[model samples]
Target: MKRIMLTLILLVGIGGYTTYAQSELSLQECLKYALTNNQQLARIRMEEDMGRFKTSEVRAKALPQVNASGQYTNNIKKQVLAVPGELIQEPGKTVLLEAGTTHNVTASGTLTQTIYDQSVFTGLKAAKAGEEYYSMQSVQSEETVIYNVTQLYYSTLVSREKMIVLDANIEKISKLVNTTGSQVESGLARKIDLDRMRVNLTNYKTQRTQAQNQYLVQLNQLKQQMGMSMAASIDLPHTSFKEIESKAVGALDFGGVNLDNRIEYRLLKKQEELQEFQKKAYKAEYYPSLALSGNYSYNGISNKFDMFKGSGSTASWYSMAAVSLTLKIPIFDGFARRSRVSQASVTLKELNKQKEETALALNTQFENAKLQVQNNLTTIQAQKENVDLANEVYNSTQNNYNLGLANLTDLLDAETSLTEAQNNYNEALLQYKLAELDIIKSNGNLKSLLN
Candidate 1:
């Protein structure tokens, strides 16, 4: 008997551990992990980084760049000549350019300052504009990150909640089976009642198993997407969808309202501005440019490659500076510049269209979300009544069975009905939670709430 009791206690412990492993996870932690660690977010952030560097690159072009150069020459043979009279006497003969070991070396520093350059200026400005555009895109990406995290988090919550409902039903059905077994042993119920109970219990068990599997799968997926470590376990918090569902069913604080706060809307606006910048830059391409540049050098020549020994060499230094003006008259280029302007203009028009289309789509989505939440809330209200009614019916039938007024069949039917109604209530609660989350997401408020 002690051995049997020990075995039972171990089984219970195992069951408890399993239940705890499937516990509720916190929303805040999930969102944090997902935003910071998700691979998609990381990739998008890399793009944003590239944009930042590009912006710096654009700015760098406007600054002066200094350069240095050096040169060395060695003569295999030193040409000899009398300073002047000997060179005149030897005019018929080949006269060398230098005497003794001849060496030529030059080192210089040059600076080019762009006083003005139409193309560079325009390109720099465009690069800056591009960076701003990418930064705006990152904003949109952040919204996307928020959206994806909420979706997976809430979706997993829903699945786990659904599994809880199934598990409850399974428990209730198991109890019914036990009750029927008792009745059969007492010869008060037919064997068929026990068989029916077994079948119902088996069905509920199957459903519970499926729900459990789905819950685990969703949990794993959420964990992986959030870049959670395998060693860390997910524990979801138990949340009731009742009040949220009720609110969703009614008109929200923002019914038939526009969410200009949406990233997509703002992104489209930025795109329009970007197009304008491009058009302006294209226009600026026709302007002229001016720049200033100068260089200085030091040279020492000798038979040796010494830096300081240069007595035998003619060492002289010269410097030059110039101001330049460039005129890009845009004489003709097959109308390519005009074509680019047209392209930019066309893009602006397309962005306008895109803005319109996105607004419409968002409106449709919010409307649908509103309707779903309201409908689910209505369902919850009705399911609540059904649960109460089923509970009453089960109680009455069980009382009758105990008093020998109703048979096992009636009691079993009542039990099954009550179980189903309870499960339906659970489903209604979860639907309400999900619907509310959807509304928030549609309004572009997921970031504010989750992150």
Candidate 2:
């Protein structure tokens, strides 16, 4: 009995875990998941962190730098020096003497501080712009992810809706086929009518199968965009058509919108700022640099290699300290600085042109999104009315055929009209949703999708 209980518990546990892994996601949940799990967004976040470290690295150049160094040498051949012998009362003669020490060691610690360096200071300032550029890039990446995920989410929803419509048509036609079969048996309908009903039923079943396949494909795409496993089964709850229609009732006004509000435009502006900093960094190369440096050093020398021993004829040691100021003035660099500055200036000009072009382009996109939203909303309303009319016609024809007042041909035509109307309505609805997302993105409010 215990073994059976354990087996049941294990099976239950596995089932629960599988269900959790395949849990259904709402649009907001999908967006949130993508932000946290999408590989590209994670990379962008890492890049932002790297940018911060880079800024710190550049800033450190302006701070005091301290370093320690040590050196030891075994002079296998001593260096000889030649001097006139007159100082030792040997006139008109030259003497050669070897320098002392078979072993030597020196250790030093040095500190350097920059007092004035235009180039370093410019680089430090540029670091801030570089950080800002990376931050803007992260924001842009997030917006792009949100846009793409939302698009896939809505597309999957539409495909599911299409499947529902197809299923309904199949069910309705199956009933009609049965009714026609009965009428032919009763000799009230011609055998040809029964044939027509069967053919219509077959077509509806084929369409339904195609729609089901399409829905599965779209669901897989949505899963990929959300960074979920493609094999995971996700169930999306049915969304009411009325709910979608309600969201599109109002016209969007973009007259007060500015290009700067858009993330893409802001990213371009950040790029322009970074380019200006680059130009400044290049021009700073012509300025002189000044620094302060100090060093403390110890030197030891001996005939033997025991420079650190205190027992047997210890080595002599001496300490020295010095502080100095260094000034480097750029006199000429074979026109290298001139060429770099010119190149930087040209790049700055190019960025300015790109900024202008981007602004114009953003404005155009905003206007077009606004127009598309309005047009698609109108289209949705018209298609909704058409679908309603088609549905009513199908119902009336079905009733008439049951009463032997209408032929199977009339019923099949009504079914086709209804199917076409539903498909058109769903397509228009999808377009309106996409247009709404565009407007939101153009207004720099794509983040609102999370809400």
Which candidate tops lDDT?
A: 2
* lDDT of prediction 1: 0.69
Tens digit of lDDT per residue, candidate 1, span 375-402? 8878888888898999999889878877
* Residue range 316-369, candidate 2, lDDT tens digits: 999999999999999998999899889988887888898788888877887898
The backbone clash count of each candidate, in order, is 8, 0
User: lDDT of candidate 2 vs native?
Assistant: 0.80
Top-TM-score structure, candidate number: 2
Pairs that collide, model 2: none
- Residue 53 Cα positional deviation in candidate 2, in Å, after optimal superposition: 0.6
lDDT of the candidates, in the order given: 0.69, 0.80
Query: Could you tell me the lDDT of residue 155 within candidate 2?
Result: 80
